[model samples]
Target: MNAEFVAVFVGSSIRFAAPLMLASTGELISERAGVLNMSVEGMMLSGAFLGAAGAWATGNAALGLAIGMLVVLPIALLQAFLSVTLRANQIVTGIGINILALGATTLAYRELFGERSSAVIPGLARWSPPGLGAIPVIGEPVFHQVWLVYLGLAILLATSLVMRRTALGVALHAVGAAPRSVDQSGLSVTRLRYGAVLFSGVMSGAAGCFISIGDIHTFTEGMTGGAGYLAIAAIIFGNWKIGRTVGACLLFGAASALQFQLPLIGVHVPTALLVMLPYLLALIAVAGLIGRQTAPLALTQPFRR
Candidate 1:
């Protein structure tokens, strides 16, 4: 690829990666808190729908984003309550939440929109950098992205800073690594996990917002498809750090972006095969268990009282 191609490639790569990165990092946070919130797919789909609906209703994309974020909180709290305070099986509860979200979003769409599966909402505007958008190699792509892309980057950076530098971060790690010990010190393991899961929920909501409002500018039934699951895979591939997860998401995103380019490049893979690239890569990655990034000791294991 030439310079323009390279810029477009990278720009598209980041745009595609942003949603997954947000969701993956959110999953990483939730999982790290010793809670297995597996409803990411459902949450994302729900977010996608609500975000689009919110925009359509309010005519403001940012308001739509807030609506999506609000939508996930109750679900996250319920999951945390069941799995953490009650000491339920984290996996089962998470999966249950997933089912609930899927059903709820679909039903809402049918009821409100009269069974139409998808529609484009009022999307956020995009802006290219002033005076730089015309640069031969870098114009029109990276410079012309929506605000959510920059927000994704900021979130990633902030998450990293918190992970490495804050006492709250240390406490979260403690809860994940040894909740019993955290509880021994009277630090409220329940609170930490609750906060972590809620944070994940908000981030996932933002991800959904990006998909419907920023990337696709529309919400389609089952549009998220399996991207939430893919986000989890990315977290594994990235070894649980925000930056690493972004990198992994970008890698997968590039593969996704390549789909449109394939025919142009004269590589006519089967359509199904083209679509399967990201998931296939995920499977291949998990097969080797490369580097074996370990989760916290208590991850996915509910803590009682």
Candidate 2:
């Protein structure tokens, strides 16, 4: 391929991966804290709908993004209440929430934009680092991106540091591995788990917004598709490590970009197959094809103090 094509491909990969990166970052933290937050799909869909609607109403993408994140708090709280407080089955609750979010968002979209479905929504502005954007041929195409991509990268770095080098990180790890010990040490397991879930919700909100506003600059019913589940799959594929998970997300992003890229080079591959690539990798990862996985001991187990 030409240099320009390669540059565009790389940029597209990063753009597509941004949402996965954001969602997986939070989901990793939540899983590490022993909550298998399955409601991520629902949260993302809700955020996509809300962000689109808000931007349409207020004519401000940033404000819409804020509204989306803020609105998901109640949903996250409900997930925490059900899984952490009521000790409901995590998988079941997550699936139910996904179904509910899908229906609710679809209904809301139809009711709110039935006639104006084709209206243009404001999108987040593109940005690049001061030095990077000034580089040679490969600069603009590869570096210029929605601001959320940079924000996601920053959050990933901060999260990695916090997970590896602090008291709170230790406590979070311990809570997932040995909640009883965390309880014995006078830490509040419930609080940590709740916070983790809430963080996941907010990140999922950003991820959904990345799709609807950051990339497409429009909203479509169920536009998120299965990106949320793919984030979970990325976690599993990475063996629950932060860096590996990010790499998995990028790999998936490249696979997604290939759906469009290959066709341009006269390499006609099926779009459906490219879309399924990430999930296929996820299944392989789950089936222990890559290596043995070491999950937190108390993952998905209700902490009974």
**lDDT of each structure?**
0.82, 0.91
User: Candidate 2's residue-wise lDDT over 1-305, tens digit each?
Assistant: 89989998999999888999999999999999999999999999999889988998999999999988889889899999999999999999999999999999989988998835876899999999999997887789899999989989999999999999999999889999999999999889999999999999999999998898888888888889899999998998898999999998999899889888899889988788988887787778778888888888899999997
The C-alpha RMSD in Å for every predicted model, in order, reads: 1.7, 1.1
C-alpha TM-scores of all predictions: 0.94, 0.98
* Model 2's TM-score against the true structure: 0.98
Off by over 4 Å in 2: none
lDDT tens readout by residue for model 1, 96-138: 8888888888888888776865565888778766876677777
Candidate 2, residue 93: how far the Cα is off, in Å? 0.1
Candidate 2, residue 116: lDDT: 55
- For model 2, give the 10-residue run with minimal summed lDDT: 112-121
- Candidate with best TM-score: 2
Superposed Cα RMSD, model 2:
1.1
Tell me the deviation in Å of residue 167 in model 2. 1.0
